[model samples]
Target: MDSKNKQQNDQKKSTKSNGNSKSQSNQTKSTSSTKKQKQARFGEEHEGKLLEFFVEEVKDIYFAEHEALKALKKMEKAATSKALKDSIVQHHGETEEQIKRLEQVFELLGEKPSKKKCEGILGIIKDGESVIEDTDDNTMVRDAAIIIASQKIEHYEITSYGSLAELARTLGKDDLAELLEVTLEEEKQTDVTLTILAEESINEDASNE
Candidate 1:
């Protein structure tokens, strides 16, 4: 009887040990799965932030381009030089293409093309408006003013596109980088054109006036 009782006690102990081992194993698996989920969430959050920043930069330029479109019309009207006015209209056509390129960039990134209120562009536009208002109508002074203002806008665009293109490259978006670089080159060209216009005749004419 003593031996039988001892055997029964051993059996009970074995069962208890198995139960504890299974419970511990389940707990470990649960903990590991929780850790994996947390890691995945963290990675997603980080990626989300980077994408957000890229999108915001795109929006800023989008807004600037639209502002420029409107300002270009006003500058064309304010310009006294026939040549300058024609250049302004030419730039208007370029602006249309630039906006479309930006929209393509948004599509490549799987995002909607959007814009934010660009205070910098707005300020430049307002500055141009004031210059027009302050200067006498149909005067070379206004032409000079329009040229200078347009150059400022072009410079801003060059810087913005350069940075954005670099960011796209860093983010491994080669296609986006290429598109932005094209726009950047255009902006640089426009800046140079404005400078030439100012140097060749507009500035000298203003000085004479």
Candidate 2:
């Protein structure tokens, strides 16, 4: 009878331990759920700030393209290849159109075109200047450098336009977003064209030197 009583006591102790383990497991799950909720809220807040940042970045891109036109004109002069020169000249006109689009975007926003120094574009243009001034103005060398410089500018503009489009959409400016998207597409195409030109002609000729 005493042994049976002890067996009942052991069974009760095991049952109690199992209940405590289940309770701890449930608590841990609840804590994890709370942490996930907090993280989701934080991500939403961060996304809002990122959209605002892109808007400001688009404004900076406006001025960056303007500065790019000036540098492009210099590049046109420095270019030794006829095709490269023509491409630069054509892009200068395109850049002007791009600026006009940006102004339209500003007007749409009930704002005026304003200047802000874009350190990124400034650095790119400065690098182009160094390439133009330091490199021997040989046909091959100039074309190679021009390819590198022009592609860099195109990539930057593409990124800026794409981001601006996303921001505009987030802000419910569908028309503005569409406009920026079109420009972004054009910039990407231009970059692709440059790549094709470089591959089909520029690099081959440059290498022959």
Candidate 3:
């Protein structure tokens, strides 16, 4: 009788252990499935208010870039330093290319490339114009002023592009993100170039004046 009771208890323990193992395995599978679903949530259809907002922001930047083109032309003409003028001209060309990229981004979204005036950029441009007005032309001080104004614009672009790129990724629009990131990098490089020009000679020359 003792031997039989011991065998029964051992069998019960084995069955309980097996049951726990199965339960744990099932739970793990459930957790994994949930994780996969979450990962694939933004796969294709990005129809939401977020997307609408993103599109509007893109349009804003488009208008801002157009305004920047005009501003760059003005700045280039106002600038006395050859280096500053050349940099502005180069960025002006890059701004054109950036607009083309934004057009492509609109195409990907099945939308036409449209402009929505960005008051923020408008204000910044106005400030830049003020800088030019306040400083004397054909002087290093004007060049320094131009550099400051240009950097402000670059910083704005950086913020816009960085935010847009992240939003694109969240929408699972990797291609759009790539395009925005490229422009973001360009803006950052432009800012750095301006800084280098300032530190190398523009600022010092202006101070002497």
What TM-score, computed on C-alpha atoms, does each candidate reach? 0.79, 0.74, 0.79
Off by over 4 Å in 2: 1-55
Estimate candidate 3's alpha-carbon lDDT, on a 0 to 1 scale: 0.91
Candidate 2 residue 7 C-alpha distance from true site, Å: 54
Between prediction 1 and prediction 2, the one with superior lDDT is: 1
Question: lDDT (0-100) at residue 81 of candidate 1?
Answer: 87
lDDT of every predicted structure (CA atoms):
0.87, 0.82, 0.91
What are the RMSDs of all candidates, in order?
13.5, 12.1, 10.6
lDDT, candidate 1, 1-209, per-residue tens: 25698578656655555576788757755765686588679877976788789889999999999999999998987889899998999999999999999999999989898899988889988987887889898888889888888988898899999999998887788999999999999889888888999999999999888
In candidate 3, how many Å is residue 129 off? Answer: 0.3
Assess the local accuracy of residue 24 in candidate 2 as a C-alpha lDDT between 0 and 100.
78
Q: In model 1, which residue pairs have backbone atoms overlapping below 3 Å?
A: none
The ten-residue window of minimal lDDT in model 2 covers: 9-18
Candidate with best lDDT: 3
Instruction: Give lDDT tens digits, candidate 3, residues 1-209.
Output: 25598578656655655566778757755765685576457433444778999999999999999999999999999999999999999999999999999999999999999999889999999999998999998999999999999999999899999999999998889999999999999999999999999999999999999
